[model samples]
Target: MPTSRSSSSIWTYLFLLGEPEQQQRFFKELHFISIVTLSFGVASWLVTVALMQHRHALDTQSASLALVGMVAGVTITALGKSLLAIVVSGSASVLFVTYGFQVLIAATDDPSFWVLPLGVLITLTIAPLFSGIAWYLAVSLCVWVMLGWEQFPAHPQQADQYWPMLAVVVSMLIGLSLNVYFLVLRIHNYQAQRELATMAYTDSLTGLNNRRRFTQSARQLHRSALAPAYFLMIDIDDFKQINDEHGHDVGDEVLRKTAEVIAGIAGEHLCGRLGGEEFAVIYQGDKHGACLLATQLIETVEAAFAGERKVSISIGVAELVKGTDLAHSYRRADASLYLAKKNGKNRYELAAS
Candidate 1:
């Protein structure tokens, strides 16, 4: 049966295009950005105070507002409120923009000109989505306001007028370039991590879930399933003899064929290659349904390899109930599989209730 889509899964696809683990990593990166923003604010404030020794505290009200925003960002992040942290971070970027503009309006060559571009860069790379868009409008407003006023030095020399304007354009371009670099770097890192995770959880030979992934998936399925779940442990009959007679290449082909059969029959069910001629499935069904599936798998394998050497499978079924240990259930299924092998090797056996 098709299961309902989960809210978490939807969020994963929409926001990060990755797993829960990647989302957690994103939150951590956000927290780091918050810290770095706060640190930058502190450093810039110190530079402003040292450079303008004659300016009173009342003259630097924008600096005070930026300080408040930085503190709030730090506190909210410490509380583990990621959404609130993002909001505060965006607000801080806005505050920094106002503060930096004030400083530049006062002294154009005070080494504080970098502050405005820094604020713009923060909003572009790390701020909330809507806030990032709002920042572009804010910047356009600033440019319009500057065009009407004489913020630049009133000198006869043409260099005086054009040099400051050229600096502003270059600074903005640098910020935009940095934003693109950061975005590409983050995407590459995420893709690398996802690939590493896939390698860890998959069986390279058969393209099936390895033992570790199977165990994790089975336990999760056991917890969520509303109906009784059955663990089906399957093993190829006389697998070693086939390897001896037909060579390891044929053995590999047999393993691949078996995996294909299981995948075809299972169809969205939790199944995996549990190492070396053995496979398992966590089937959501009763004993009768489980028996029917086992019988079908046995006959399908036989028919698939009929032209060559005969191929057969033995399956062991064990019911999994709520509040029971999954490891114990697996052991019960394995024991029954051993019994099936002892009782003539080409049939299934059910574990005692």
Candidate 2:
């Protein structure tokens, strides 16, 4: 008889046999639909063998041989097919192994007839091994069927002898239904998680990184030992007055249009919404390049908003110096922006080291 540990191990193996995510990915990534189809065919063969042995008045030796053939067929099917194929094939294999053990016990009266049932009972008791809970239940149901059939009296044409077979079929249907339901739930959860992550890191209004994501990237840049980087703080001049004069909707449109201009000027740079009417840009460039970029941004915004509505911006550029953190650079850029606004709107300022 198998010990409790061995029985537990077998159950664990069966449980892990069906991982829906792995099965789906395997079929999709490797284009293994054909293998999956072939596995279904093999399952049909196992079913045929089981029905034949049950109906035929075969001797214990013949039943044992038939069971072995079924096991081999199922194993081959599992090995040749995809992950899902293995799950179904493994279920059939469990059934055949259980039947073979029973036949061997009946053939030899070596005080082991008791052991066979005990072993099967133990295997079923523990549940299927590492397979998903659904697959484990399915395989367990199949094993139970084999055990139940064996227990039936050997008399041919007994109506009660068919109960075990019916029970097995019912159990299999329940397992398959449960597996499909859980698989769908898992996929839905995965998609929801991905969407949530995207929303968390993205700005909904302007389709840029929000303040939170920008700060994270800034911190990452501070930790690196790359060449000097530039930090620019941009604020729309007289933004509140514009909202008061031209409805908030127009103000919102202005913000969106400004974001597009900033994004264009900060090509390949990290740009994000800092707050209302304020934005930030971080780029790896020298002081001169940073100033030129900032100038170009001011010019572009001025030209774009010219004649349609009066618009201007105040930009502050600061080169990230060695030993300076993101907070320090932001402070310097903010100070420069304040100076620019104070001096005049629609102008750019470069912070001194």
Candidate 3:
């Protein structure tokens, strides 16, 4: 079976690229760490090559030249660090194979003439199949080319040359795969959190903002310089009597139907269920708008409930004052609502100053 590594690699790439703002901090941290690690690898490789030359008493000029090339490569990578990390890590495998083949060629007289042909065939085959696979092939190919196939001596220790190349290829693949996996996991968690937040703020029964969300929205509106808005609290008249006379099931149906009637009349106004038998609306306009909406709501509910067990509702409207909070607005509306019930059931009242 093909490994989970490939699947994980795909997920990681998508996570990093998806929801730019949501994952921006993670991306930034990943970029910084990648750059630091890549720099260290390049530095260590150059140091190792220099030490080997010194120990073997080989020509210092060759080692010095190699060190310069390594430094230049490191500098190029650091300058465009993010892009280079992706490019290098993604293509590590292909580079290893390609440079490994060149080394093999240098060590043998008639290095398999098929090496180039086979490498090309493999590169072409994998590149179109999967991004990570294509990248691995490309990196391996680059590594083979860099190993200098022309200089591979006849009596070489095949194990030494091949093992280091294999190690580099494996390490790069592992790192890339792990990075992508964790990134995808983070994205999934973020989506779940967003869904939970939405549920918390929304009323499932009415499909409106619940009391909690209404308070939050009111605070937002209070900060704006818009026209004075109104808060209207409404309660079904003798709702407990309805539940007692008719079954609670009928009472629930009545409540649902009443919510629909109020929502239809409220139109663009924000409406929500504050609690049992009580609903609230926030209208972003003058008192006239609130009065019109209240009248419409009263008419709609009366019409809808005319023959359905003779139900009725009381409404109270309060205009938002400058420098007032949601609690105060709610209190005002509630006071008006109490007056409407006291004066007569099935009526509307505006809060008195």
Candidate 4:
């Protein structure tokens, strides 16, 4: 089942969505978040003055710049590219957070320097999740440097200012460091999971869909089929002989080559390996088209070998009728497969029943 945007662990869900559709959904989540962040920027400016003890209103110019940057961020996101939005958002956030922190300091009393570190915490919490590693480091470094600029122009009069700015730099570094560390681990884990999924659903020898995936795909295809759907069961002829005469290594290569041949013909259709030298194809088309495909499979494999080793396949195609599951259609194809072997090998048998 697909996850909703309101999923509890939305960040993890977005990263897990590597498929085309899921990726699109992930960006939609980001799009919504960007809107929220932009709204918050506007609202914060309207209320920043009220939060001050002296009732000193913050710099309207800096607030305006921040709002303008966020509007640009939201507008760029409307173009529908999430990565671009991240860059734009990160750039805008840096601009706003830097100036916003200054305005916050201006509105504060003696411990005004402490407000900058708090701003660093807020930026670290909000910024890194939307962007990649490069953008994260870039934005975090910019925030630290912008705050730490006062460190270079050290004077006895301004010595106290260095302490809080140093605190802000340390805060930014630690927060961003933790973010990078966890992101690396999560990405590695996700890649491992994806690889395992591929291994589980694919045949190791042929790189074709395995039996489990084949049955699953066939069931799905059957449901969506408008006309007629066929399950073609294919078996390599004298496969045991090849293994016995040339060893399993050559036999494995033959199976891989055979899978490629079938896959080449299957094209937009689905094919799978049913263990050993047996394979299957789920096709949607007319009986004549299915028969033509089976014929092509037979002729192509028989003529594929020019070396001392030659291979052939016997196919059994069963047209799935209404209210019939893959198991029922498979039984008919199995019977047809037996008939093909019982009569003559290197042929295809169509089960009309």
Candidate 5:
């Protein structure tokens, strides 16, 4: 059962790193990755101990410290906590390297000497692979250096095997530094992708949700069985004449102001520009509520563009029927919109309840 629980925890933790969210979320993603690597590092530490001639290879104090760090790191990671996990995991890394190096120093003349340099290289490489969290790497490197200084060869000629270890450290440092640099670049690229996605769903002229966004939101609301809602199709009355007479610039300003009025009226409701001089809105309201909103929208647009542009809106509204999809509801609203235009523009026509 313990094994099963541990496996479940690990898988759950692993799945949480789906994607980097906002800027702060990037740090959380880094923490998650660090947590996973720390777990494997601890596991490697234990595996090395188990492959030894003596089960009690580590001193009682040091062993206790390592176990505390490893277990605490794992527990905090399981709880989705990070700061304490960072601290404990750093300490665990130190103990793993230091204790392993101590054993290596003692067995320098034995066949185990072949494994010592490899262990040191692995420790140095993995510790700083997490570039953003420097405290852990600093603490681990300091512990390893302080504990193993005496283990270094006292004479230059005796340091032949040690040069390869230094070479490994240097190579790993260069490669890890490049990896960190690229990660920063990746974050910037992710930010760009986010901006591009926003642009794709946004109307460039009116700064409103584009048709694509409206379709997505409307479909979602319909599929979720949300009743007591209304869909509205709005068209600017005499828009083509205004553009043809007043020029495109004035026409653009009129569209912008009209969109502002609609957006303000539909606060927290979905409002999107369907295309040139046409828009759509979805609100969680009944026929009466939608009528009130449509009235306010018509009055506000008339008043807003009264002096300069002098424009009004024609709106068609339909209360969503149960089991009707967004496309059907929108089409019903569109039919009403045509009736509104036919009834001498600057007014609203409601679809039969």
Candidate 6:
């Protein structure tokens, strides 16, 4: 459906990465998790600072930074600036990790803050391709920094610290693998939605817009139309007889071939198969152009199947009026279609204004 090469490439990239509608969905998810995680971090830090104020002086500046960053990130996400939201929130997360690591190291020489980067695993799962990779690397860098900083500054020769560090490394590996698995699942779900939408909106037999899709689109076009518009109601002449005489297989071939011909000619317009042996096209042009198109459809279809079997079509033409609904225009076209068949099939009749 993408007409240009750049657009097609962009669609392919989006498909490969994850949800095509990634911006809004990613921002919303990020906003939600950032709110929850950052709120908890700020509250827990505030409580810790309060309880430890008398015993040991603790810095509350990082907690204040986390609160402010969360607000800014939520506002950016609401504005649909997904990349910026990630950057803001990620900066806050970095502050939390670095500050928490410092506090834990100074007070108890504990490396428990190693698990903090695991919070960023959710971002890896939800972010777009480049962003996901960036988060993964950022989290990895944070973990490595904490491990190296803790070793170099204190307990560099402590053999018992190696086991806990090893465990943290293994956990990061597992979390990264799981993030990849969930990202694949997310892409599969988005593709499934697209396939289901196509099945619902497309005609399986002719590959045209089904009646439901056609009516919805036609009504919207009618309401917004600025140019002169016309509707053509078309039917295969004596289609039942063709099916009865030559088997249904032959009838199906005729329908498919006819639809192809109509689509080729009216491909630029709103062409669709209304029902069995009935097709319609909504053309944007004057009366003369509409009549000429109908004539072309009759001539082309006849010439396409001339050697195999005689196939012809009757078309009804009705100009769309600004004040009238599409249904009224359809009825007018249907009336003219009847007359075209009555006066002798394979002809077109234009409905009077």
The per-prediction tally of clashing pairs is: 0, 16, 31, 0, 0, 0
Which portions of model 5 show Cα errors greater than 4 Å?
1-20, 23-183, 225-227
Best by lDDT: 4
Q: Residue 299 deviation, candidate 5, in Å? A: 1.6
What is the RMSD of candidate 4? 8.2
lDDT agreement of model 3 with the native: 0.63
- Order the numbered candidates by TM-score, best leading: 6, 1, 4, 5, 3, 2
Q: What's model 4's lDDT at 74?
A: 53
**Which lDDT tens digits does candidate 3 get at residues 96-154?**
33433343333343554434443443344223212233444444455445552544332
RMSD of 5: 9.6
Q: What lDDT would each prediction earn against the true structure?
A: 0.69, 0.67, 0.63, 0.71, 0.69, 0.69
> Per-residue lDDT of 277-298 in model 1, one digit per residue for the tens?
9999888888898888988888
Clashing pairs in 4: none
Candidate 6 per-residue lDDT, tens place, 87-141, comes to 4555445455445534533453343443434333333333332225445546555
Lowest lDDT block of 10, candidate 2: 122-131
The candidate, 5 or 6, that scores higher on TM-score is 6
| Best model per TM-score | 6
* lDDT by residue (tens digit), candidate 2, 1-353: 99998777455433553245545543343223333443443455356446653443436566657566665745565454465555455555555656654554444444233443434343433232213565656456555545545444344377675654454556555555555454445446656866897799888888888999999988888678388888999999999999999999999989999999999889888899998999999878788888888888899998999889988899988877778678888999999999999998788899997
Off by over 4 Å in 6: 1-44, 47-56, 60-63, 81-134, 143-154
Cα miss at 89, model 2 (Å)? 15
The per-residue C-alpha lDDT of model 2 at residue 243 equals: 97
Regarding lDDT, does 3 or 6 come out ahead? 6
Worst 10 residues of 5 by lDDT: 11-20
Model 1 clash pairs? Answer: none
TM-score of 3: 0.57
